[model samples]
Target: MTPYEDKTIKDSLREERKKLKDMNGKDKLWYIWEYYKIPIISVFVSLFLIISIASAIYSNRFETALNCVILNSQFTSESTSPDDYFDKGFRQYINLPEDTKIEVNHSMSLSFEESAMNDFTYAELAKLSAMITSKELDVMIGRKDSIDHFGKMDGFTDLKEILSPEEYEKVKDKIYFVTSDETGQKVAAGILIDEADFEKKTGLLIDGPILSVMINSTHKDTAHDLIRYMFGL
Candidate 1:
């Protein structure tokens, strides 16, 4: 048998150490790299993968109950984060469990004006469409132009279908209707918010903000509740 094939792990290690001990510094480095590069690289790769998986698992440990998007709105103060105000308020309002999570995404911005359309605007629009298609988006709050843009695309659920009679009656006057592109009929696509009141409550500044529920929301009931919560109804 060949010497390599006959050597045990210990014997091979000993022989390697003897060779390394006899070598110059540069030669030892080259020899080690030549002999152990694959194992060394494999170890690092395995560690990286393990850490990545662990981080992902830790981040996703909590169940996501609601996902709301607030487009084109900025916080009143630099220190005011979504988690500190809006998310916390909604969690308290609904008495959500500690283990459950609520996501309020306010970073995305889009403009409906042809003159304002750019790469960023198109990217945000694509992201919004993708979220709706995946049923990951529940509620949307934005200005009339933004709401109208999505409403015309059939992005929002008709309020009449989801809200109870009493609930409908309460916000009937505040409803924002849009023409459905497919049905060629007016649908209650959004609810107009009292921007001043909303600003006071959430510390977010938006002009003529309107709230709408996504058509394919997995959490329709929570989205309905969010409307009432936002309006303080």
Candidate 2:
């Protein structure tokens, strides 16, 4: 071989050895990403699409802007002016104060699976994980399993702290509370809706699911107002 060709080969081998040395010292996650980049990219893409589509839907519908994000099994509320609609129909809006005229907008997301311990996949939790990580979630209305799942994630605010003394007095006896043992501290992981209210509204006498605020919610006041409106407080 030519002298210049020999030098070029040695330089290339030195660079390859240095790269190998660096790669050997890389963290576990770096190696995992390198090996599973395609799947990781797909998961993130799906999560981004979910968030983007939800954002688009919210922006287009609520020009007044979102007051909260509700992650529920299903969304039932559609009429933005429910107070006005019910007011005209049942003459009940007058019961609410004039200050309750806030235009509360919500971005809702459905659960990926029903059970927290079931055959749920990582991709299923992608949207939820992303939302919580972004600190954008406000309210979550869901079942005990979901509450337990998120409560373990340590992202949900303690409802006991959020509810006022008077309000808690009214609701304390109505709903059921689920306690979670976190670092030896017993925290409320979930709360079922008032059985009387559920039966009155849905005609189902069974005890129902829960609704709680997110720990990182930006619109706590708005969330509280919506809750008051919902429970007819």
Candidate 3:
């Protein structure tokens, strides 16, 4: 070979060796993935964080929905305003106040038996129709008192025997029936209306299935607001 060609070949070999030596050890290992590791790890971490946040938010929403249903079912009430009352009518029975008084009084003069009976038969039959037909009064009597109906009953054929025709009509359709005794008689003689129909018949506000005692004694604004929110007012 010529000396000039041999010198050029040696120089090329030396340059290649220097480049390989410079890239040895940790530097070579780091370069293998240096351009991609940081971004890949960052993307995975970000995805995990986002998924965790979404799961937490979903769990919270489920808990909230469950709480709302439970509260609404337990603390139903009647609305006082005409508009609110109608809105609640399809869902509940309501007792109305004759007038807002300094002292709101709830009377419990009758039992579930009496209430039921009064709903189906007049007081006269209760007093004197003991031997009437089986379907005459027994089947007709309701099991509870009508508090919101203001002690009223509609389609009560016998109420005129106890009340003036005018008085009976004024209060009958507005009556609410409750089980006279805690052991209610299973009489299906009274009117069965939805919340709205009850309100229309009685002129009262009602929300859910709360007891009479609770309705008369408790302040209803919070219960009403909760119901409105839960059910979407």
- TM-scores for all predictions: 0.79, 0.49, 0.16
For candidate 3, give the lDDT.
0.35
Query: What ranking of all candidate models by lDDT puts the best one first?
Result: 1, 2, 3
In the range 1-233, model 3's lDDT, one tens digit per residue, is 88656777779779756865789688765764575688878999999999999998765553110100001111124534333433344223323332221111111122345445564345433432232222212112122333323223222222223334554355455434443232343211233224554345334334432222122213233333332332333
Clashing pairs in 2: none
Give the poorly placed runs of model 2, Cα more than 4 Å off.
1-121, 175-181, 194-207
Best by lDDT: 1
State the TM-score for model 3: 0.16
lDDT digits (tens) for residues 65-178 of candidate 1: 889999999778565566765578788999899889888898889898899999999999999888988888999999999888889989999999988898899989999999
List RMSD in Å for every model shown: 3.6, 14.1, 22.6
User: Candidate 2 lDDT (Cα, whole model)?
Assistant: 0.56
What is the C-alpha RMSD, rounded to one decimal, of candidate 2? 14.1
Mind giving the per-residue lDDT tens digits that candidate 2 earns over 22-116? 76556555766786799999999999999999998766663221233333333343433323333332224334443332332223334435464
Write the number of the candidate with greater TM-score, choosing between 1 and 2: 1
